[model samples]
Target: MMSITYRLPQVRNLVTAFPGPKSAELATRRKAAIAAGVASSLPVYAADADGGVILDVDGNSLVDLGSGIAVTTVGASNPGVVAAVQEAVTHFTHTCFMIAPYEGYVAVAEKLIEHTPGDHAKKVALFNSGAEAVENAVKIARIATKRQAIVVFDHAYHGRTNLTMAMTAKVMPYKQGFGPFAGEVYRVPMSYPYRDPEGLTGAEAAARALLLVEKQVGAENVAAVVIEPILGEGGFVVPAEGFLPALSAWCTANGAVFIADEIQSGFARTGAWFACDHEGVVPDLMTVAKGLAGGMPLSGVVGRAELMDASHASGLGGTYGGNPVACAASVAAFEAVEELRLLERARHIEGLIRQELGDLVGAGVVGELRGRGAMMALEFVKPGTSEPNPDAAKAVAGACLAEGVLILTCGTFGNIVRLLPPLVIGDDLLTDALGVLKKEILAAG
Candidate 1:
């Protein structure tokens, strides 16, 4: 028997079906919540979580393959994380760092500078979410370059804020009818290798993008070219090696700041501290948030000292940007990553996903299998056709959920099945989750 501490996370089923009697009763209350627009895509109602399994209020245990949208790299309900949160909660809940400031905030910033890529003198500004970090990165760029135009890429997802909405690309939910966005924002075609015209290498793709920027937007007038080193909401797009380097070089040559939105790809998600490390192309600035606090709301823009200092002293702060409790949690999370050797686990996770689902790509049911380390996806399509098969992907995902595993869908076409399990998941648990996922993909065929 697993210890009580460890056993709660293991798969244990007592109810007749997934959402047992107790969960059904609470779901009625949740219906009221849904009426208020608070319900979520997954309705398991986590009673507890450890390792990788989330125990629902219904008494069923399902694997958490999504990792709360890649925020919990060190696992949900980790003992260390819980202890750190509880300790901080007892001491004080919220004292706005901008008002009085505290060591917790200072410590987290130190850790951010230490962990974030680049060996140059660095500084950090904390925020509440990925969107806020993106907005702040924009502010830093505009201030540093004294330019108004911010450049974004196609199919990108920066945030929901007015400014980030302008930077974001997709139209339906993110931009639909939410017009009058922040001004001077421009769009560029991202080098999504899977969809790019045949025979276009990464370098050629970057050169084409730069030429477009120069011709249309006048690169000299642009303030920043914001990019996700590994595109997150846009199907985990991993540009070939030469792509980022070329883009960064272009930004440097043109006097535009290169802002790497590392919110989704940073913190060892892609087998590196930041995906930009894949090509040794460090950005002038970087934004991070999702996994920084191991689930708490804490994010920061860490970058070159000169650039970070460029902003006026009081121009970059907010009331709750860096709460003391969240900062404490972030400190613990940073410590956990190094002490737990979680980077190796991320690489191991990539291996497991590839080993299990790789043959599906050749079978042609899968359009592509892409991404790095733990941040991976299997994009589905109509067999022998390039068209996306979102319906088929949905059916497969439904099957996985029914079989007691949770998987998430992504991609511009909504045909990609992404796997982002906790980096600390047990090997046996990951093997079981992948086994279920493989069965569902084949069944979808």
Candidate 2:
């Protein structure tokens, strides 16, 4: 596999303290201009980024493990994506697919159809963000099924849109004060092996969730059952072995659409084209974004043609959905993934991370090491107990940031530190970053 050529040096070098004078000055300007509601995890201001490193204005090169929330699977500055975007802009910026439908839009749709799970006749509707894709998927599911209730899992995070906010589980940041949200969304238990009762099997967990749906919202009233194959923001939780298959089976038997929100786990981030592929559980409607466009804002809902076509002609669309430049980037991202063999690269990253951090489980600092491929995370907990330790997670993340390594934290309890490095990241750079992570995690104890 060939790696993308990046001009920026792929080494972590801190020439000045993090958020140095330049970044501090920018922060002041940002506070004045940007909304207070918007927050950034790191204080540094990135001037340039390529491969595995982000260069701050202060001349510090930080090793990136977050991948901008898993959007840059092919690296932030991939040559193919950059060239495609540049060439596309020269031809035309935006004609709005809703106005003068462009070939790039159709091409991206075609790519989505081919890559997304299932061989069934599929159609795709593009959108500007993952939230839009998810919202639209729910809309499509409701229209197709003529049902009123949507089922979601506990600790699930669909998005922040009104309807998605109703679908999401967390309250503080994503959903708090965001109401009144759309109604008819029901929550059920997810098969979180790390937290589930001892000796609970995947099938048993599915039965429990199904029983709740049956008792609360009848199967006849359910529009769709949406879940993340490998839950994102809710802690990179990889459901138990038979959980996904069981859910999919239940959805099939109940006439509810099984929608896999692969926004954070798609595009080779989880060592597969999609996480659903790991279990051979094809979703009726799959919402995709994040890594779809190599950092360009683009998202889509790809699924059964019958369901996608159920909506009225103008029922689905956005003025900026499937923008020409973004479509070009998406196409190039697909090519980059193919040429770089990012699926294999993701698996390699998983092996490396597991090998480096697996010992934490025995040390008792890590309650569990979950997730797949590059989308891995460490759930920090009190030694010899499952009690969450958000402080430990924060300390480890902060230490890594101070040492010029960028990491991200998630989970309902905020006790998990997620690692989402770009697939193009070099082995040496990844090793160095992991070393920093190990040292900090150990020190946190």
Candidate 3:
């Protein structure tokens, strides 16, 4: 096995139907108790999860290719996280960093500054979620640059909060009916190689986007240009080479803060400490969450010391911005990343996934197989054309689910199948999951 630390068997086993009786009952209960807006991709309910397997309420052992939407990079129930949390909870749970600060919070911030890119002096502020981190990042950028306008890209997904909803591009699910979003947020074109006009170089894409910012948003008014180095909810879109560097150069020249929203692609999820490392592009501010604290809810904005300190004391902080329990979990999670060598593990998973699914491209329905490390995706399109085919993506995911593998779909077109297995997954389990995925994808074609 791939050095699985969890006790659960690293196997996909379906003791009952996809959503067995227990899960079906839970789904029935969920309909009545949960909000209609909160939707679960699968009807199954988890009873326990560890390593690469999720033992559902129905007694099915599902192969976890989704990794709780890329949150459990070190695996759920990681021993380090569990032990640290257990120790921390026994001592104290909540001592909001703003009131009685603790070493765990400071330690976590130190870890973020150490891992984040750049040799420049850096500082960090923790938060409760990705949206909070992003909102605060914008606040810091604005205060530092004394500009109001915040620039984002097409197909970007920042968060669901008001400001983030304004930053987010998708309208149907996240932003629909959540209107009257925060203003001063501008949208720009992304470096989408597959969908961009043919032969458009990364620099060309950068120029095109910059022209829009200059003409429409006014570069002088732009406080921050926020983007995901690898688009997360926007289909794991890896920007074309030279795109990021060009943007960074423009931001520096114009004094607009370049914020890398590394929520879904940071903390060793993309085979590196952060996706920005792939291109050697360092941001003025970096927002991080998802895999930062294993499965705990913790997020942070780490950036240049001056910009991060632009806000006066007591200007930024929430009631539970840095819960002691969460901070302990984050410290443990960072240690797990180092102890388990998850950065290399992410790359190893990437090689396996590419070896298995790389050939699907240009094979009728699959137009692209892209993304780095464990955060990979397959874009489904109509045969012989670039037209999106979300149905094919859904069909493949459904087929895999029926056989006890869980995968997630994303993209503005909803035509991408994303794979985000825990970094601690075994080779055998991942191979089995990929086998199911490949078989179903071929079947769909």
Per-residue lDDT for 156-272 in model 1, tens only?
889999999988877766778888899988888888888899878889989888887888989878999999998888788898769899988889998999999999999888888
Write down the lDDT of every candidate, Cα atoms only.
0.84, 0.93, 0.93
Q: In model 2, how large is the Cα lDDT of residue 422?
A: 94
C-alpha RMSD of candidate 1: 2.2
Q: How accurate is candidate 2 locally (lDDT)?
A: 0.93
What is candidate 2's lDDT per residue for 137-197, written digit by digit as tens? 9999999999989999999999888999998999979988879999899999999999999
Report clash pairs, candidate 2.
none
Model 2 ranges with Cα > 4 A deviation? none
Candidate 1 has its poorest 10 consecutive residues by lDDT at: 1-10
lDDT of 3 by residue, 116-202 (tens): 999999999999999999999999999999999998999999999999999999998999998899999999999999999989999
The parts of candidate 1 lying over 4 Å away from their true place are: 1-7, 12-14, 34-39
Tell me the deviation in Å of residue 290 in model 2: 0.3
User: 1 or 3, which is superior by TM-score?
Assistant: 3
Screening candidate 1 with a backbone cut-off below 3 angstroms (N, C-alpha, C), the clashing residue pairs are: none
Q: Looking at model 2, which ten-residue stretch has the lowest summed lDDT?
A: 1-10
Q: Estimate each model's TM-score.
A: 0.96, 0.99, 0.99
Candidate 3 achieves a global lDDT of 0.93
Q: Considering lDDT, where higher is better, how would the candidates rank from best to worst?
A: 2, 3, 1
